[model samples]
Target: MQPLETRKDYTYGTLEQNQLLENPLEQLSVWLEQASQAGILEPNGMTVCTVRQGRPSSRVVLLRGMDTGLVFYTNYLSRKGTDTATNAFASASFWWAALERQVRVEGQLEKVSSTESDAYFASRPYESQLASAASPQSQAIERPALEQLVMDLRTNYPERVPRPEHWGGYRLVPDYLEFWQGRKARLHDRIVYKFKGGKWKKERLAP
Candidate 1:
């Protein structure tokens, strides 16, 4: 099949160094709020990339917390978990097309404390809790069998569902972050933050 061609000229806005918050996380918070206010669906959605044995994989996940850094949850034995276990490093990115803005983060990943995972799991909806408990993420299973597993879990735990040991959260401690803003004629703006000397240093990159 022949490939199709398409293009868009971004004329949304410009990004200036003076407009950035001294702290990259603060700047991210501001952009996230704007993305939400702009009516973007799932503004917290991000693409997380992990490497295993020199091969990389990517998937979309919701941003769940920022108390210490960017936090997300998954099965402890999932592909992502396996990758992080061996490599310890990962990257995540967020793109708000409507706002013509993007953010990228590279960092080391570590599992959140079991207590934190338990609290987050407990707060999830009852159905969601059951689903997480039933599904073995990144594993292959027949559709009917998966459904039956969920039904059995639901029947067995009518009131309270205990968080599974394999289900938990991971936090990415960033050493690098970049914010990109699209501009007219494709002359986009790129601002980068690097953690060095126990502080964050900011710089700009050419589009």
Candidate 2:
């Protein structure tokens, strides 16, 4: 690429402290809805980052549930799952570029109840259920072998596919959340909500 210089001002909107909701989770839900309305693809997609042995790994996962906290599903034996098992802390972030908005969440991670996981798994499409049960996530495998596994699963479970014991959902109970909105020039907007003393404390940060 030639000098690789790309520049654009963010004139979309501003994130003021007064515009934020008292409950960060509720505010996040509102933003997520707006992102979907704005036609942004995969509005629920978020970057989930986990640490293992001082090393951090990040990947995009679709947000599945948003009741008490952010929820996503994956194999317990996966890299992210293993990392959370070791550290119990992770961060998830969402960037709606078209909306010039971003949100970051950081907190303790815990596995959701198996019942919840099973319910969500049951709600998934049949192909997704098979894929989750068949593929050994975060592992090396040949394409043909993987296909064979899926085929075998289809043969065995012709009706309702059972959720794998190793696959489930995890919820990140956030203690910290930051909402960002792009502004004119290099000056952006950032508002943080920190859980303190059993209540949420809202504050603004220099951007």
Candidate 3:
């Protein structure tokens, strides 16, 4: 058997010639839209990184929604959830190589209201709702036991499954946002927006 060669050309994309966006959020939205148009699977998927005291951890989660802030859902008692409790600060990043774009955001997280959680929960699939109720997120258990628990819950609750009190949404209100575009000769373009004194200041970063 022959060892596989690892090489690819990235000359197909050019970032310098692309028009610069006026605002960072607008730029991110544009790139996100382009990623979706380019058929990148789960374009809204992002990695949420949080620190528990001094230990850093990260997990991939679907972006349920975002505006001025990035929103995601999870069990409040989960590992990431507990980390947020100890340290409210977090960072999230989105990468879509097909579009040669990435966006990174750092901010403090805050819990959304129960009303918001209720609304989102009501919209989830019935199976997902049941699983959410059955699973003790971030807790350890035997695989078979967990599956049996889910099966038992499904059998017991064939109708409406109420949202667990531990489950909810969190919003990361970004104070810093960076947009990166892959460029030629490894000179990537990086534009950062920092919140300062009731206004946003834009700056270029060394790559």
- Tell me how many clashing residue pairs each candidate has: 0, 0, 0
Give me the displacement of residue 23 in model 2, in angstroms: 0.3
Tens digits of per-residue lDDT, candidate 2, 34-148, equal: 9999999999999999999999999999998798799999999999988988899899999999999999999988999999999999999999999999999999999999999
| Predicted candidate 3 versus true structure: per-residue lDDT over 1-207, tens digit per residue | 766883433454544423556556667777878898899999989999999879999999988887768789999999999999989999999999886778899999999889999999989999899888888999999999889988898888787678889999999999999888777676777778898887877887877
lDDT by candidate, in order shown: 0.93, 0.94, 0.85
Q: CA shift at 192, candidate 3, in angstroms?
A: 0.4
Clash pairs detected, candidate 3: none
For model 1, the stretches where C-alpha displacement exceeds 4 angstroms are: 1-4
lDDT of 1 by residue, 1-207 (tens): 755664788888888888898889889989999999999999999999999999999999999988658999899899998999899899999999999999999999999999999999999999999988999889999999999999999899998799999999999999999999999888999999999999999999999
Taking all chains together, the TM-score of candidate 1 against the true structure is 0.96
Instruction: Check candidate 2 and list the clashing pairs.
Output: none
List TM-score per model, in order.
0.96, 0.97, 0.90
- Specify the highest-TM-score model's number: 2
Q: In what order do the candidates fall by lDDT, top score first?
A: 2, 1, 3
